[model samples]
Target chain A: MMGNLLEHMGVERDRLHFSWISSAEATKFVDVVKEISDKVRALDTDKKFAKDYTK
Target chain B: MDTCIEKIRTICADLLAKGKVQKVIGFAEGSIPMASRPIAVTSKEDVAKLVFNATCGLNLANYVSDVLPKEGKIAVTAKGCDSRNLVTHMVENQVSRDQLYIIGVPCTGMVDKRKIAALFEDEITDFIEDGDTLTIVSPQKKEKVSKKDVLRHNCRVCTHRNPVVFDVMAAEPVEEQSLDQPFADVDHIAAMDPAARWAHFQELTKNCIRCYACRNACPLCYCPTCFVDESSPQWVGKGQDKTDINTFHFLRAFHCAGRCTDCGACVEACPMGINVRDFTRKLNKDALELFGWEAGLDMEKRPPLDVYSPDDPNDFIK
Candidate 1:
C-alpha cells in the first residue's frame, strides 16, 4: 500500500526494492544486494520526489 | 431522553463538586436549531448547560488534545468513535489517560444538518426524534423523515455504536450493527482503472477552496507544527495550486494511516460537502485488510504501524 502511495507521489516504481532474507544467508543476501544495485543503477538519474537543493 | 440528560448533569455536578474533575467538557444548546456548541463547565451550577442529543456530533476528544488544561482532571463525553479517538490520543501520548474522566454515551446516531437542509431546501427550523421517526420543520412545511434516512452517512454504516471504554455509562449498551463488507465504498474506487481513479479523485477535489477545516476538525491532527506549516523544509507550497492541495490532502490522510477513527468530524466540518472520507476510508480499508486490525477499538493493542512481527504480511515487500 505504501509503495503504491509513493509511486503516486512521483517516486518511480522501479526505484523501490524490497526483499526478505533471514540471517546467516550470506549468499542470498549478496544476491539480493546485486539485484537491488542493478535496479538502482538502471534508474540512478531519476529522483522525481527530490528537489534541487542548489536553489 | 430525560434519563440521559439527568444522568449527565448529575454525574458532572458530582464530579465537579466532589473535587474529582476540575472541569466537564460536553455540548450546550447552540443558537441554531440543529447544531450544538462544545462548552466547558467549571462549576456545579453550570452543569445544567450540558446537553447531549443528536446534534452533539462534534468530537469532544478533538478539543481535549488541542487545549492542554492548566490543572485538574477533565471529564469528557464520548460516543463510540470519540472514545476510540481518546484511546488513540492515549496511545499517541497526546493526552494522558490518568487525567481524563470519560463519560461514555450510547450514541443512537447524529443527524446531518446539511442533509436536512438539502432535503428541505432550507435551514432546519426545528427537529424532533421519537422512536425511529424524525419530524423536521422547515420554513415551508413540517415533514416526517425516517430517522434512519437523516442520519449522517458514517453513523448509518457504523459498526461500533457503543463506547468501548468509559468511566461512567450514560445509557444502556446499544446493539452493534454487523457489516458484511465495510469496504464497499473504498472498493468502488479501487476497482477503477488507474487513470480513471486519478480523474475521479481530481473531480472529487475540484471544488476544494484550500480550506483546512477538515484538518483542524480531526483529533489525530494535533501536531503543533503540521507538515503543511513547516517553513524550514517547505514540504508543501502555500497556495491554491491543485497539485499542492492534492498533495496536502494525500499526505494528511497518510499521516492518519492507522489512527483515524472514521468519526465523520472531518466530513461534518467541510464546507464544500466533499466526502474526504473517500480518501481516509480507503486507508481504513487497507489498515484492516493488511493488518487485520481496526483502530481505536482496542486499548491493549497498539496501532498497526507501532509494532511489527516477523509473520507480518510481506507480499508487497518483494
Candidate 2:
C-alpha cells in the first residue's frame, strides 16, 4: 500500500520493491537485487522527494 | 434539525442519569459561527449543551480513546464517519465495542466553513441553518445560500451517510451520494506527468508550517511518538524546509494508507487551508480499487494492508 501510494504521488515505480525470499534462496535474492538496481538506474535521479537542507 | 438535537440531548441525559456510561462525547456550540467543537458531558445537566447540526464537522471519535475512562463506559455521538473511525479503533484495539454506546446521527453532510467564509469579505457574525438553506450574517449584509453549495468536498463524495454500526439511532438515515466519478480529484492528479504531479503536491504543501494539525485531528494517528518526532533515527527534519514539509505530508499520508475514513477532520483542522485529503485520498482510491476495502466498516476484519493473504495482489513485487 505504501508503494502504491508513493507511486501514485509521482515517485518512480522502481524506487520501492517488495519480495519474499527465504534464507536458502540466495540465487533468488541476488536476481531480485540485480533487477531492482537495473530498474532504479534506468530512471532519472529522484530530485523531487529528496530534501536539500543546504538551501 | 432541532428535533435531532432534542433527541440526542434526551438520549444522552438518560444514559448519563442512569449511569450507563461514565461520559458522553458530543458537540457543543462554538463561540464562532459554523464551528461546533467537541465536548465531553459527564452529567445530565450538561446534556442541554450537547447539540448536533451540520456545523458539527469535527469527528467525535478522535476523543473516544483519549477521553475514555479507565473503569467505565462512554457514550459517543456518532455520524457516519465517526462511527467508521470507532470501528477502526475497535479493529486496532484502541477501544472496545463493549466500552462504547454509539448514538448514531444520520449526517446530512457538513458544510465547509471555508467555502462559506469565502463568499463574504467581512467577518460572519452569525450563521443560521433552516432545512436546506443557510443564512450567513456579516456586518455588511445577510445572505442565504443553499446548503448543497457549501458542503465539504469529502462529504459531497461520501457514499456512507448512515452509520455502519450503531447502538442507537438519532434520526433517519440520509441518502448517500452516488457519483459516477467518486475519485475524480485523485484521477486528475494521477493523469498528470510525474514532474507535474510532484510540483502539484509541492505547491499544495508549500504553506505547511509543520503544525501537525492534520495529524492531531486524525484518529488513526495515535502513535505515542510520531515518526517525525523520532530523534535517535531522525526520519524528517523539524525545520520548515520544503523537503521536510513534503516528507511530513508524504509520511503522514502513508501512515494512514488503508486506515483513513475520509472524515475530513484533517482538512477542517488545517489552519493553512491546505487540502490534506489530496495525499490520503489517493491511498483510499488505491485501497478501494486494489483491495476492495474501505476502512472502519467491519470490526471483525483487519485492514487489507495490515494483514497478508495468499491471494493478495503483488504485481509490484519482482
Candidate 3:
C-alpha cells in the first residue's frame, strides 16, 4: 500500500520493501535484514533519497 | 434542508439549556456567501446561529479532536462521514465515547464549491438547491444543474449517507447512493502505464505549495508533530522541490492508508484546487477490496492496520 502506489507513480520500486517479522522471531528479523541489505547492495545508489537517512 | 437547520438549533439549544453539554460544536453562517464556519456555542441564545446547508463541505470531525473538552460532554452535529470519524476517534482512544453527544445529520450530499465556480464563468450572485436541481444565478445568466452533477466526488458514489452511529438524528435518512463502480477513477489511473501514471501524478501535484492544508484538514492526522516538521534528522524537506513535494504527499497518504474515511475534508480544504483525495481514495478502494474493511464505520472492530490476518493475501510478498 505504501511504496507500490508510489512505484506505480514512477518512483523506483527496487528501493522499497514491505515485510512483517515480529520481535520474537529474531532469527527471521536478521535474515530479512540481511536479504534487504544484499538487495540494496546489488542495486545502484538512489540519488533521490541519498541525502537523508533519518531511520 | 431547512428542517435540518431548525432541528440542529433546537437540539443544541436544549443540550445547552439542560446543561447536558458544555458546548455545541456546529456550523455558524460564514462571512462569505455559501460558506459556513465551525462554531462552538456555549449558550442557548447562540444556538440560533447554527445552520446546515450545501456549503458545509468541510468535515467538522477534524475540529472535534482539538476543540472538545476532555472532561465535559460536547454536543456536535456530525454528518454521515463526520460521525464515522467520531467512531474512529473513539476506537483510536483519542476521545472517549461517553464525553460525546453526537447529533447525526443524514446528509443528502455537500456541493463542491469549485465545481459550481467552474460552471458559472461570471460571479454567482445567488445559489439555491431544492431537491435534485441546483439553481446558480450569475449576472450573465441563471443556469440550473443537476445536484448530483455538482456533488463532491466522494458523495456521488457514497454508499453510506446515513450516520452509522448517533445518539439522535436531526433528519430522516435519505436513500444511500449505490454506484456500479465506486473506484472507477482509481481503476482508470491503475490501467495507465507507469509512465502515464507518473505523468498524471506529476501534473496533479505540480502546483502543490506544500501548504499541508490536506494534512491539517484530515481527522486521522492527529499527530502532535508531523514528520514534515521534524527537525532532528528531518524526514521530509521543508523546501518545495519536486522530490520534497512528492515525498510529503505520498508519505502523508501512506500514513492514512487503512485509516482514511475519504471524507473529502482534505480535498475541500485544498486552496490550490489539487485533486489530492485521489491518493487517499485509492487506499480506500484497496482497503475495501483486500480486507473487506471500510474505515470509521464500526466501533466494535479495529482499523485494518491495527489487526493482522494470517490469511491476508501476499501477492506482493516476494
Candidate with best DockQ: 2
- Model 1 interface CAPRI class: incorrect
Poorest 10 consecutive residues of model 2 chain A by lDDT? A46-55
Comparing 1 with 3 on TM-score, the higher-scoring candidate is: 3
State residue B15's C-alpha deviation in candidate 1, in Å: 1.1
TM-score of chain B of 1: 0.95
- Isolated chain A TM-score, each model: 0.73, 0.84, 0.68
Instruction: For all candidates, state DockQ relative to the true structure.
Output: 0.22, 0.72, 0.38
Candidate 1 global CA lDDT score: 0.82
Off by over 4 Å in 1: A4-55
Candidate 1, pairs of clashing residues: none
* Best by the lDDT measure: 2
Would you list the C-alpha lDDT of every candidate in the order shown?
0.82, 0.91, 0.84
Report lDDT (Cα) of residue B237, candidate 2: 93
Backbone collision tally, model 1: 0
Model 2 has a clash total of 0
lDDT of 2 by residue, B123-234 (tens): 9999998888999999999999999989999999999889999999999888888899999999999899987888888889889999899999999999999999999899
